[model samples]
Target chain A: MLEFLERIGWFVGLVLVQVLVLSHVHIYGYATPFLYIFFVLSLNSGIDRNILLIWAFAIGLTVDIFCNTPGMHTAAITLVAFLRQPILKGVVIKEVEEEFEPCISTMGFFPYLKYTLLCTLIFCSVVEMIDTFSFFDLKELGLKIITDTLITLVCIFCVEAVFRRDKSEERF
Target chain B: MRNLLDFLIKYKHWLLFIFLEVISFVLLFRFNGYQGSVFFTSANVVTGKVYQMTNNLTGYFHLKTINSDLVQHNAELSIQLEHLKEAYKKLTADTTVIEQMKQEALMDCRLIKANVINNSTIHANNFITIDKGEADGVQKEMGVVSGSGIVGIVYQTSAHYAVIIPVLNSKSSISCKIRRSDYFGFLKWEGGSPEFAYIKDMPRHSIFEVGDTIVTSGHSAIFPSGVLVGTVDDVGDSNDGLSYSIRVKLFTDFARLNEVRVIERSNIEEQLELEESVVNKER
Candidate 1:
């Protein structure tokens, strides 16, 4: 359970990196790269679900605080966390039923990549939708999600290629 | 009941997640009620200090430019002084008349030097940041001006920095009047262009032409009379020979804005006293 707290530490560190470092990097115009979701997706397999939802809100609130968009991050991260059960069901093929976090350990390389990609996409899309639906123009709304999700996908690919290689080899 | 309680405990994080998300969403869609909830504005103390550090690091490279700006300002002052001297030489013959005119026309004011650090010209409600802040005696609602013309009014002040809503922002308007004809109107930025703005509320009877000099009407406490604003460019608020909107070419090139002088009105209290008396008598 203390390891659950440790996972949160990783999330905070990644969010700091997102706000401090990646927030400055603009591929063209869009800045936010959706790096914090790595925390939610990479929780321990034995992690509790209710706590996961709270974690989702914390991550989103943290982002909204830094970005000045109050409710957008909270809504998006919560939506992703709420849908994790079904999303995990769709991705995980193993028959094992022990409650665990959806991570690269239980779900293999291809399956994990697909899962992260879907979660990142859905989270980014949900956030962008909530963010721009108020006053942001349609063009801005569309571009925001597309670029954010694209950047997130690229970051997830890089993170996995670098971090999950040993685990994948051990599984194979 | 015991089994239901255990099941509810198992799903607590999910409920918490929904609760937190709802809280965040409520804040996101809310705009009107939340006026001071700007925790992310660069004007925040920690973030402002960070930017100040960055500005200090970058400020070293621009010393030469700042110095030249000071020198140019001095040169203009010297030229105006010479003009005043010449006018004095001619008017000394009628010293009594000139003295009376000067007493009625001249107002005492001082200028505080400041440098621009941040500016947002693209937003409809544009804002500019100045290096001078509350620590340097800058208070809210002080009039800001450039060498060329009136810039805007001070909106917010931090310890070491102040933010101004310039004439180019839709959220602000400056009272201006025609110099030759004494027609008064409110000048405003329409949220489209920086170099241009419109003067509203002028009656159709007001005669205006291109190249007419515009100045502050001195009707508002923020700006004193005779400060340059801009020149009349075009009239557009034509409805049915009732009212005409006049377009003004702003004197300050907001895009090229760098140095500014914050006008510190010394007699503000006394002026406010006189104004309040008038209002009290009226009431």
Candidate 2:
């Protein structure tokens, strides 16, 4: 129950930050870091797939509602959620079969980095493609995808580092 | 039946994923029809309130710049007012022209003041949310303009908030013309930069320079004739090499947009009805 409440808190807090602060930050003219996807990316790997999908849908829809893009975020985040299990399995080598959240502490730095990078890239590409909804200008589309992915990667890593330090202190 | 139920349970996650994606696409493609439903938009009460509070905080930071802009505008307006006063004195002897001026004034539109609560420019279809809405007499198709120049037309409105489809959107096509040459075209945004847009379908023979001013043609009832839009920045040919596509540097900076005026044309309904009646008669 406590874990559920913690998850809910992170959900709301991330959405608020994304809507109020990060959504307005358009670096240059192309990149806007979608930090809210971090919630979906950080969900425990052992959770029920259906529940995970629902959680992803909820966060994505909340963001879409605020940003005025009806389904762009929802679709992208749901896809990320669906692929999260496979991505974790592919990136992280499990020493023991146990339920754990995917983060730097449990998965180690390099694997977690790979996991975050892959998920962020997928999420950014999907969202940007849906936002554009056209292949007319592949150059602009690729630029947006690459820039958005890189920026979001950097932000996700920064956030992960902060959270990792907090968790380590709590453990100590 | 047992096998089908077992299969459903087996691949339920895949089915759910497909179902949710399908719902998202439906909501996205059908968004045009759903504009009237404000629940999913920034104009909704909850989002509007949040954005309003955020704007209140951020708005303070923009005051210095806004004040300077207002001061410069005031100086220009006073100079133009002086010129207009001199012209009025010279034209006082012509009663017929004065009557015509009165008639033109009668056709002029009124403006409702509003502040920008939420705005986005990075999206392909950019939208801006303002504090005023239906209760403030803001309606769909009403032209929105900042102090500098044209902003956009109101796309949807709730009781206390409205969303504007700014010129940066790919779907936004406003009638604009070259100021000096009077050559007109449909202004379009190909969705890269917010600072510039393309005016397509201008005739090849239309004479316009790089720095020529572009203004609303007022072919549509939304914006009045001669409202400032932008200045021509570059010129090129259309895809078929038949018409000219001139690039325009939009005057209203969407990034720093804070306050705006929604132009309420007094005779818009009457004009629309008249035009519809003519179309119906022909049909």
Candidate 3:
């Protein structure tokens, strides 16, 4: 119950930050980091797949409501949620615990980095594709997808590092 | 029946995923047709309230720049007032005619002041949410303009908030003409930059220079004639090779937009009615 409440808190916090603060940051006129995806990225691996999809749909729809782009985020984030389990299985080593959440400390830095990079790339590409809905400006679309992925990846890593420090301190 | 039930349970997650994706796409495609729903948009009560609170905090940071802009505008207005006074004295011979024209212009429309609560330019179909809506006389298709120049037309409105489809959106097409030559075209944003838009369908024989000013042609009822749009930045041939596509540098800095006024055209319904009557007569 307490874990559920904490998850809910993180959901609200991330959505607010994404909508109010990060959404306004258009770095170099191309990159707008979508850090809200970090919530789904940090969920426990053992969680039910159906529940995970529902959570992703909720988050994406919330963002869509705020940003006035209905279903654009919904479709992208839903696909990410559906693919998360397979991607995690492929990336992580075999010895990890079933209920363990994927983070830098648990999955090791390189594997975690690879996992995040792949997920962010997929999320950004889907989002940019839906936004433009056409390959007419392939150069611009490619630039946006790359920049958004890099910026969002950097943000996710920074957030993970902060939480990782907190968990490590609790161990001491 | 047993086998069917077992299969359904076996791949329930996959089925759920596909179902959700199909629903999402439905919402995506249907959104353009029914964009006025308040629940799915930022103009809804919850989103509007949150944005209003944030704007209050962020509004302070822009005060310095807004003040300077206001001061410059005030100075320019004072100069114009002085020139108008001189012109009024010289035109006293035709004073009745000038007064009649002034009254007619004033009677055509009124301005309703509002603040932009939320705005975005990064998306291909950018939208702006304002603090005023139906309660404040704002309605769909009304022209929205900032102090500097044209902002956009109102797309939707709720009880106390409204959404504007700014010039940055691909769906937005405003009628504009070159100020010097009066040759007109449909201004469109092909996505990528907020600062520039392309004016399509200008006649091939139209003569316009790079620095020529563009303004609303007033061919439509939304904006009155001669509202400042932008200045011509470049000229190129349209894809069909029959007309010119001129690039315009927009005057309103949408990135810094704060306050705006919704033009309430008093005669809009009457004019629309008259036009419809003419069409019906022809039919």
**Ten-residue region with minimum lDDT total, candidate 2 chain B:** B29-38
Off by over 4 Å in 3: B34-36, B93-98, B277-283
Across residues B9-106, which tens digit of lDDT does each residue of candidate 2 receive? 99999999999999888878877554446888899999999999999999999999999999999999999989987888796977788778878875
Identify the CAPRI category of the predicted complex in candidate 3.
Answer: medium
The candidate with the higher TM-score, 2 or 3, is 3
| Deviation in Å, model 3, residue A137 alpha carbon | 1.2
Give the interface RMSD of candidate 1.
4.8
Best by lDDT, which number? 3
Q: What is the lDDT of residue A65 in candidate 3?
A: 90
CA RMSD, predictions in order: 6.3, 1.9, 1.6
After aligning candidate 2 to the native by TM-score, how far in Å is the CA of B173 from where it should be?
Answer: 0.8
| CAPRI level of candidate 1 | acceptable
Docking level of model 2: medium
Models 1 onward score TM values of 0.63, 0.95, 0.97
Q: Pick the candidate with the highest TM-score.
A: 3
| TM accuracy, model 3 | 0.97
Question: Residue B214 in candidate 2 has what lDDT?
Answer: 95
Tens digit per residue, CA lDDT, model 3, B75-166: 99999999997988897877788789789878888999999999998888899999998999999999999999999999989999999999
Best by DockQ: 2
lDDT of 1 by residue, B1-283 (tens): 9999998788776667667766775675562133434343345566455546655676677678767877998999999989997888886877787778777654567788998766645433456778888889888889999988999998777777777778976558889999999999999776546788888778878877889999999888888899999999987764455688888998888876777999888778888889999999999
Candidate 1 matches the true fold with a TM-score of: 0.63
Give me the displacement of residue A5 in model 1, in angstroms.
12
